[model samples]
Target: MRYLPLEEITEDMCLARPIFNGDGRVLLSNGVKLSKNYVSRLKEMGYQNLYVYRVGEEISDFSTPISDQTMREAIHGVKDAFGKAAQRQQLNIRDVNEIVSYILDEILTNPNVLYNLMDIKNHDNYYYHHSVNVCIISTLIAKEMGLAREKVKDLTTGALLHDLGMVCVDPRILSQPRKLTEDEMATVREHTNYGFQLLRSERNLSILVAHTAYQHHERMDGSGYPKGLVGEDIHLFGRIVAVADSYETMTSGRVYRKAMWSHEAIRQLRESAPEKYDPDVVAAMERSIAFYPVGSVVVLNTHEEAVVVDVNAKKITIQFSSGPRVNALMDLEPDSEIKIEERLS
Candidate 1:
């Protein structure tokens, strides 16, 4: 399956993966042939890219660190938990814990998998999807850093609910397409305190979990919000979530900005490391994320355009787009002189 920008998707290209709505219902099922109308509609809905089967190529499901069902359940659990909290009802800590546990198990099972944040997102439920993405990425970073299993669980739980305080903010303010006023920005920053109070009140949750919500915004150089804490003042869990949260936020489409490419996001993180982010945590994140995700179209130093088929392969697999080697598969050796120049999409 090739991941292509919506603008490049033409009629009759079959979808290789299902697209889900905010409620987790399938908007378009796998193997559905795309038409011009379907493509237009999807673009209108803010979908940036899609997974489609390359001509005459049939394959089994594309592998992910966690299954689609698990992602849907996690989104549902986060949405439901936020809803309950918004209504002043008890948050479903057990449901959230179960979702995190399942995610942790999947990551542990595939310890060597480099996570690709390529899931199609629905704009209406950005928070739910963002929460899950941060949790998954945080878990991967934790595992890569060799944190203990129990600590990983705590980090996962904290990362999953890091934005729980946003439930208290007005939805309109959160979705505003324009720059937030200084007053409006203050209200949004208060979410950390709001979330911390809410999580701390839960008898079953750890204090560290509550701190994750409070400190994910705090930076290493004492420039972050809610608190200007420098390095070490931020808890380990908080520092870890901060990296995951920032990376996910930057790479995710938001009301005010478009999503960034993974490589671009990584570059920004590296540029700001040990200042706005913990250098160690950022390094762990780099080890866990796929800079060149599968299904991406990239340009090689040899001036050949190829589509990445598998990043996890011992030698990465690339299919040349055209020329004498058109449609030919080549293994990109780790130390080869030929290198990827840039990604086209």
Candidate 2:
């Protein structure tokens, strides 16, 4: 499905998927016919765009970054570097450094576009999709933290390589859909050190960037692995990545569970246990995340459905097929009669 802006949502476009509100309730059934109220409600809610579920490639590639091909090329290009980095008996920091450099080049050259491209990382190719999601999560966090453009590039690079050490591990462990045993989890935790050691051999890469790959999984509460250093000791880049990593991991679709809606996902991060992540970072990440991101379908609590068309200075205003735009995305306090239903996959 393609996302349609609220202004662009017409009676003509069809609903290919069911839509729901944050409460896990269905608001619109699939195949429901469209109406004028759909547009009105969506606009009232401030959802800028609507997703057209069943579309051709022509529509799918209609985005700003226009870098799917470029990204695919880069993804494969870096795969070779990762292979080289992984094969050495001793860590080869050069590979990690090159990998990070390439990623930074991509982000710096096209920040605004790729920056926005994060919203659409759900396409095929999990590896590339993973890269895109990491970029989105990291960029959002960095931007909200008020980092300068150059620093944004550095964080983006760190995020792209944060999992480089994982590439050295067995694919079976990384791709497993179920929970891992303690032993398996231990092996899984090796990525941090392995990544750091590998990057240690490289040249000119900043310690901050290298540390991101190694320490991102390390938590603030010291519940993390590979030398579970607690808060403050964890590098700033590492800390930034921790929130970004979890945000991407929990919110995105997995073999085990459906991807949670962005709003719900933020709520989970806010309410979750151990206080493993920094609370401030969580809040920044939430504001940066596109809860009702442009071009996703949503249903209201009023039994009305809309497609998010635009992001206002505040709320996500949805363009509905039958309802009016709600006043605020933050005021998610279920309007007894109005609410968002579902996030289109």
TM-score, cand. 1: 0.94
TM-score of each: 0.94, 0.67
Output the lDDT of residue 307, model 1.
80
Candidate 1 lDDT, tens digit per residue, 94-194? 88889988998899888467776376875777788888889988999998889988888878998989999998998888878777999999999999999
The Cα error of candidate 1 at residue 182, in Å, is 2.6
The whole-model lDDT of each prediction reads 0.84, 0.58
Candidate 2 structure quality by residue, lDDT tens digits, 1-345: 345444555566665434432222334555554567875764454333344543221122222332443454445544554666667643344644454455555444443332222232222234444654575567666666777767666677677667778767788876676778888888988888888887666666666667788888888889886779898898777777887777777655544565565677778878853368777787777666666655566766677666554453244445555545432332333233456766643
RMSD of each: 1.8, 10.4
Top TM-score: which candidate number?
1
Off-target runs (Cα >4 Å) in candidate 2 are 1-74, 89-124, 312-317, 323-345
